[model samples]
Target: MDIHGTIKIDELKKPYFVWFEENWIHDDVLHHHQKGQLVYVESGFQYITIEEKIYLLPQNHAVWIPPNAVHKTNSHSEKIKLMIMFADISTQESFYYEVNVFSVPPVLKEMIKYAEKWSKQMTVNHNENLFLKALFNELPQFVEHSLTLHISLPKDKRLAKVIQHLHNHYRNEIKMEDLSDTAHLSFRTLERIFKKETGLTLSKYQQMLRIIKSLEYLSSGNLTISETAYEVGYKSVQAYTRSFQSVMQFRPTDFIKTIQ
Candidate 1:
């Protein structure tokens, strides 16, 4: 898919701040912008693909997408409430070029909410400018709370096909040998290439997909623990819990409690 584009910010004035609340269902084309972007998920989960790696942003968390970074997004839930903001590139010196996910502090969260309300009611003014300045100033401190759970993709076309297949069939029982056949490579070669390109074995990559997907299922609050386990292809709840804890550093129950 030729899903690539750029977002121009020449129309936006300096010290610019914009907020949007969206419920995205379809996947967006990969694109980049000259201005930095901040995305905060207030309710549901979002899957962001950046540099061939997919990062899952669950509720109550935010991601900073620096200027000129190619990225795409897929919403995993209905009514996925997101607060998207754009800032001028010259406003901050410590802005990162890489995507980073961090916990949203209550103070910053309220600031964003207030900005959203204010933006809807009026245009940017002196008071709003001060809010934007303070928001940008406090953003750098939250970078230390970055969380990483990235599933890397390979550049090789054959391996890329295999990875896509696994992503589509993650909830099903998939064998490495079968994947090798799909990629038209020997099982050993498939294993080697997968590790070399993605720094993860095929099994581990599959596990990461499952765990990340489970976050969406659990966040919905409609599935029981056992149901979620089975939904993610885990035959047993214990196995699912182990994988969840290993990837998320917390049990599924505890995670649900926090998000709730």
Candidate 2:
């Protein structure tokens, strides 16, 4: 959804704007706006590129885009549902300065969905405006308490191939030798370069990718915990729970409850 068309969001007189889009498809063109933006995913995942870095936005999560930050979002799936907000209020807090992707608590998610009634603008000093302000005020606390499930992509061609291999084979057992061969580098060289490019160890990055994939499985509502764990390459539910908690700060069962 590009706000750069004839209807510029910054020109609106309201202090806040909210839009809930269903089965949405984005233009994927790089664009930015004057007001800070918050995008929450109700279903399906979105890939958001900010400043040349791509972040994964899974279901039941939200991403914050700072004011005037060049960003673009894309989703190949046609079932994506998004709750978007444009806020004109001043936010000098550190978290508001850069893009962040964090899990949305059930309460905050409900509050945001409740705002679907008012789309573009809400009258000032009215109940709708007050409700939206309360919802926005509650976001920072949730962000502080929740872990940001950071999933980023590499730009280097060799590393990009390695990343693709990992993405395609995350459900199976992959070894360092295989990854090294995929990258066409020595094991040690691949390790050093992968860490340097992604700021994450290869093992950690792979585990994060697996867990993110597992989120997709669980959100579908057709998989049991054991089924989802097995789909993500976990030999046992215990191991899967540990890895999921390490990345999400919550257990798989807890996340399932959120979706239910």
Candidate 3:
């Protein structure tokens, strides 16, 4: 069924939790629900596209999706385990109005594990009810740790074509003049509009794409760090490591160790 149809018919009238451990290879169609959604990735990584923005949710991180905000998810992994919790709109009305991705606190992670088990038993007690309420209350604290992983796409068709070209050839040295020609706009106009619409310079956006693609390559465990670096257009491993650490706040080796 289409996502919109499923959500419209299966509206959550009360707080609930649903856990999924599956191999997601295809993308979900854009959809929205009336209840707020807090999705946590326990393993693997997922790309969530909301409106014109796409956010990467890595392992041990989570994203809060405001109620009725259109979004979709995609992943290139075989072990994507996720926990999705739903709260009535009335209860979380003031929680968030847009997607907010952040690191999951250890305490909150444990609570989510318990909530997953509790949800299956369909048992509700005073203590469990209170626990759920507390979990909901603790969500706002994560807003501060939100990551800048989101990349907003341009809406203009001409600009979008240029962006698409960058996505296709991110591993090569793309010249600004070439991009301007592709978009059929002057260099100055293209630069200004690209920054204004996406809130990132064209160069920065290309780097962001390369970094995100590197994550997928690294997760596959088939390539060495140097190979991954070269595949993502880094001429040297040192340069790639620096860029990765600058954006992710950790070395690639550290991430590999954690996942291993």
Question: Across residues 53-163, which tens digit of lDDT does each residue of candidate 2 receive?
Answer: 667777787888888898887553458888898886586877777777777887888788888888655355477778878877777787865445556667778898888
Q: Candidate 2 regions off by >4 Å?
A: 1-7, 10-13, 52-54, 76-78, 122-131
Return the candidate ranking by TM-score, descending: 1, 2, 3
Q: After superposition, how far is residue 185 of candidate 3 from its true place, in Å?
A: 1.2
Which model, 1 or 2, shows the larger lDDT? 2
**Model 2 lDDT on a 0 to 1 scale:** 0.78
Using lDDT as the measure, the top candidate is 2
Candidate lDDT values, in order:
0.77, 0.78, 0.75
Tally clashing residue pairs in candidate 2. 0
| Cα-based lDDT at residue 62, candidate 1 | 86
Q: Model 1: per-residue lDDT, tens digit, 124-207? A: 577777887778777888666566557887888889789889899999998778888888999999999899999989988889
| Model 3 weakest lDDT span, ten residues long | 1-10
Per-model C-alpha RMSD? 3.4, 2.9, 3.1
For residue 100, give model 2's deviation from the true position in Å: 3.4
Q: Assess the local accuracy of residue 186 in candidate 2 as a C-alpha lDDT between 0 and 100.
A: 94
Question: What TM-score against the true fold does each predicted structure earn?
Answer: 0.86, 0.84, 0.84
